[model samples]
Target: MNDHDRTASEVAHSLSRRQALKVAGGSALAFAAGRVVPSGADAQTPPSQPADPMQIILPETGITLPTDEVTFRWVDSGDSKALFFRAYFDAFTQAHPNIKFDYLGLPWTEIAQVVPLGVRNGNAPDVFQVPQEIPIAEAVREGWVRPIDDLIPNFPAWQAGFPPVSFVEGVNVFNGRVYTFPRSTSRRAGIVNYFNRAYLEEAGYNPAETPLTWDTLRDAARKVTENGQGQYYGIILVGKQVGRWEQYVRNMGRLAGSSAGPDDIDYRTGEYVYTSDGYLAAIELLLALRDDGVVFPGSMSLNDPQARAQMPQGVAGMIFEGEFTLPIWVRDNPDFEFGVSPIPTPSASFTPMGYQNTGTNHQWLYAESKLPEVAAEIFTYLGSEAGQLAFVSITGGSDPSVFDSVNQRAPVDERMRTVYGIYEKYMRLCPDVRIKNPETSQVYLRLQRPTPSFGEIVQGIYTGQLEDPKQAMQDLQDRQDQALDEAIEAARRDGANVSRDDYVFPNWDPTTDYLESDYAELG
Candidate 1:
């Protein structure tokens, strides 16, 4: 059978097959040099500038349009510190007086609560920043946002400017249409093991030849513990918040080979494997650290911020954190010198491991915009090299530069170098399980909602509340599988096109990460 027939047959046997989708919309006209071009058609040259400020070539279409009096309603998840947004808005407006922006910069927390309400009320901004925690699929399905392929000219070429990894499944793409533009690289690229350089030296260990294996890291921690003499801890952990615990589990588990997060999939089988050897080994590692008395006291009671503070304050030798932590340390504890390294992997794995998110917090233009051309202009500009640079300069390189040129053009601060190195060498992209059935994302979210979460399984073991780490993981695996099945079945009942095959990851080699061709074959 051909691919289409195969898909139909699979859907029939497994889940539901959707009917032909008729999107309610009119297509935009792409006019260039007095000729009409199909949307997403390739352009030979960059868009030519028009004599009138109001009349400029649309980058996506190579079409010239009058943009004067067009006001783009932009809502962003930024606070007062995000002066870069205001700067960009002023610069863009000054450059083009005919075009205007109605910009609202709100805290991320507020944006999360307000944007959804605005969207539901048909009063949402023309262009808005996508929420970090919420899945973008929900908004696309609800018709709150529209695909950019038709709106933006030469969409695929425009998207190619970004790194291949940025196109996360079920995030930037839905129903084979590109939805959002990646605004920034992940602030937390992977699990960063930040260590006090002085502490390592004082412990008679060479910082250059730091730990690369799990066993050696433990030995190094013991050395730091011996050097501390009851005054400090070798390693600090944050167990109070669910996210912190989850990071610990993921960081440690990656070292052993577990790719299963709250809703992550095993690329090899397309199933959740929370009880894999990697996860259980990670839990056991934490238990060993506790028994060895290397973990900081009050870890269970301490909040994330409190736990994070210990490393900078010299109370802990190392911290398992993210790229953003370096900036905090730079601003607050400038006198303290430190270095970043990846979480040590097992001897068997050999390669260092860190978690990576495929997509990022992005900016999307609402489908129901009054001034689409104006909104498209702002969207395209912000995603451009110049616009991204302005934001990157202000953010102090905590986020990896999306533009390739920005990295080369940098003054190259120590922090930026560290982030670059970590992302390039250590970070491993986390598998997205919701690629096939976007509706199933809720199953993973629900697992995090409960008090004693899958991440908290380690904490349970650490506190003596749970005895067998393997059993706890096994139980979670079963629960996750059930949740996955229920979600797929319910979504099929609701006319969503999904099946068990969506979860399958055929011909994926976990050891080598496989090649891009392997992924293409599965698709």
Candidate 2:
């Protein structure tokens, strides 16, 4: 059967209603064993009308829900996060008694493959979590997902409560339409320096006072490392992992005020600045750290998990991580103490630039779902202070909340509070290259494609395999530009409303902020 041709009834009926966990006739029940049907006489009687919604004091979500029986299917990623969602769903179910949830949980690896295929097969989850790497615009453009602006009647009013930057063009809204709501921003929303208190104290430095400049940081690292005399090391770098390397490079590059990192684009000119001076400076610093013997000896060979293992064992003095790292460390070693601070720069005079507002894990409603209204209600609830707070608390308040009310309820750990405070002030959305061209949008997704992998390039530099950072970066730039040009030309031939002119900016100045005026078009 053609997936697009399936009717709502066909889709709904096709699901294994026999096995679904159900709340039938306002009564909670486990997964139904098998479909139970009324006999001839019992089936003939008139069905009872649903209880008056006005009478049910559904916990105040601040939004009104229509009185209807709704069965919502929701798929999510990650086991820990899934537990959080289940708790939220339970709370939601208690409030909206008429609705039932058929929850499906899968890891991100499976989710990327399963969700879209499931949706096309007409076995779609009404509300599904979209991974950060997926091209949301492409999903919407291809008619795989729907806009929530019209589906949720109170969406506009509710969205207005969030930070205005949340709706920046190409960040959240695409082509003036809102499709997904960010469940939470990156836990490490800004550049945070996570350091071990014991190590700092052992080195005769104050843990509470983080180094503000890169020179001081390097000195501190050297002092703590003691020329690799003990098991203790200055830092952990997962040189083999692209994400870990990319993060450090981007945060450092920001201080130098240039476009860098995999996601960074010169908003002013729509140009790839992977080879910018700031990026080179970042690499040079890493190389310097390596030469100083401050980095863990096995860093070049280790992956993220292996590298992070050094933290809990007190073998590393400092690390760069997001807010979530604190909780994970706490869970592993409750007695261990640490401090959080901003990533150090070359000088205090340099502007702090690692401000990133890129939405990481977001939730999108399937356009083909039969119960969008119900999904919208659940979506709004999840984004609410009450819902976000539940997740923050479950995650140990390490992940900062998007709403002020939820942050107010954040755990009073000094480190968490300090990190959240910095996040509130400095977090920003990085310029997106994904929205720039046909090819760039799929850069993260199409790993098999011919573009250079930032991970391999960084690993080469770290292992002394790649001699010149500048030449390597320039080569990367040439290849990336070529890919973009080819994609643009192909798109134009296919009658796409895009041109090379959309990417050019004659008046762009790298020294100044790439404000909205710098761009000819956002694309």
Candidate 3:
């Protein structure tokens, strides 16, 4: 189905907003219901003197409280710019008055080093938030964290709401159990192409509306380019950084029915749809834009922030980015004329306009902590409806499920409305893609040397440094296998289970042919 041809009904059938809410019942509803105490009730009054954190009840899921007050220390990676940690702490404290939050805000770069050290020194917060890429499974296997299954019953609900893909499948799960719950879900979509309606009209074209397909984008770029010369180009893309390049590749991969997950492409089988006709077609189309001079000059050198800056200043016509970019655009240039829509799909089949896997950022509780019960209560409440609402309100803009009540109570920007609309109708959590064996994560990290070094591989692909795609993929597979092997060996030396066959990969192939596939159908 073409992007335009695919209806909200079609996407809804796979993963609807209502179903997402139901699957995320505890979290979604908790956020919606507000505080459990009666309105104007003094939750900390003499009689109520804030029951020991262990005494708090997770009423939403019927989970009992712990016997001790658990102090959850968390650090925010995306702080200052975003209030994610503060919102979570605020909602958590209000719901469970006894539990205290030792909140810390840190840059993303510092979290990797700080978290591990904190764990060694016994100073790690009982409950903390970590980025999806930080090898959490290894932490779990190392006894730094705890398995969450014994604490709550709504885990299944949390898992069902995610999409079936490699990254989600590979990074979130360890030993067939979930260790993290995502904070904000994200997907790679075509960048929001911002056009100066004023500029388009001056160039003899209607700027108010434009088709989302690649061809339309190119044609519009051509028209816009004729008017501006070197001062502006029809579009801007991040090509210099491997991370941005990988995003581009992944976005293109989505159009071809692939993602960064194992199920979509099956790296083990050496079958990648990336080199397939559909993917190649998407690449050719993108390259055509570059060749036609429709892309901004030195686009390869531009990072996301730099590219976004051009949009408000009218230095560029269109740029592709994620949904998060909308808020910044609104904050910086209130009067900029722009519209939002899904990326266009290929002519053959209607792939959803956006990528499927939403990023997973989760909070885990320590099983061995002195306050498991209290920690569980806080964990459950944070995942509850009231908690979700509090988070949404504090963050200002979050998924509709988190802020559904607030969405109804206040007027929201069109961009936010658009994001909620898309998520409600079409968003699917990418299947769990993290390492199942916590030890394997350690190996992956060791082999990669520095975590960000993986970008070099991506850069090689974008810059044509690696001429053989098959070899490049094979090398990655080897490195991953080696990493897994190293992790397993280390575990064995430590008398832990680390066998090569011990790792379990989730099955996320949507194209699998099955007689009983109806159960797997999105509807």
RMSD of each: 14.0, 10.9, 10.9
| CA lDDT of every candidate | 0.58, 0.59, 0.49
Clashes of each: 2, 3, 45
Of candidates 3 and 2, the better by lDDT: 2
lDDT of 3 by residue, 282-345 (tens): 5556657767988888777765556666777776677766565665455435678876654555
Question: Which candidate number maximizes lDDT?
Answer: 2
Greater TM-score among 1 and 2 belongs to: 2
Candidate 1: residue 425 lDDT (0-100): 62
Worst 10 residues of 3 by lDDT: 16-25
Error of 2 at 208 (Å): 4.1
The sequence of per-residue lDDT tens digits that candidate 2 reaches over residues 293-346 is: 898777776644455556777778887766656655554456677887777777
Query: Model 1: runs farther than 4 Å from truth?
Result: 1-160, 163-169, 175-179, 185-189, 259-263, 298-310, 348-357, 363-378, 427-453, 456-468, 494-497, 520-523
lDDT of 1 by residue, 15-42 (tens): 1111111111143212110111222232
Candidates sorted on TM-score, descending: 2, 1, 3
Error of 2 at 297 (Å): 4.4
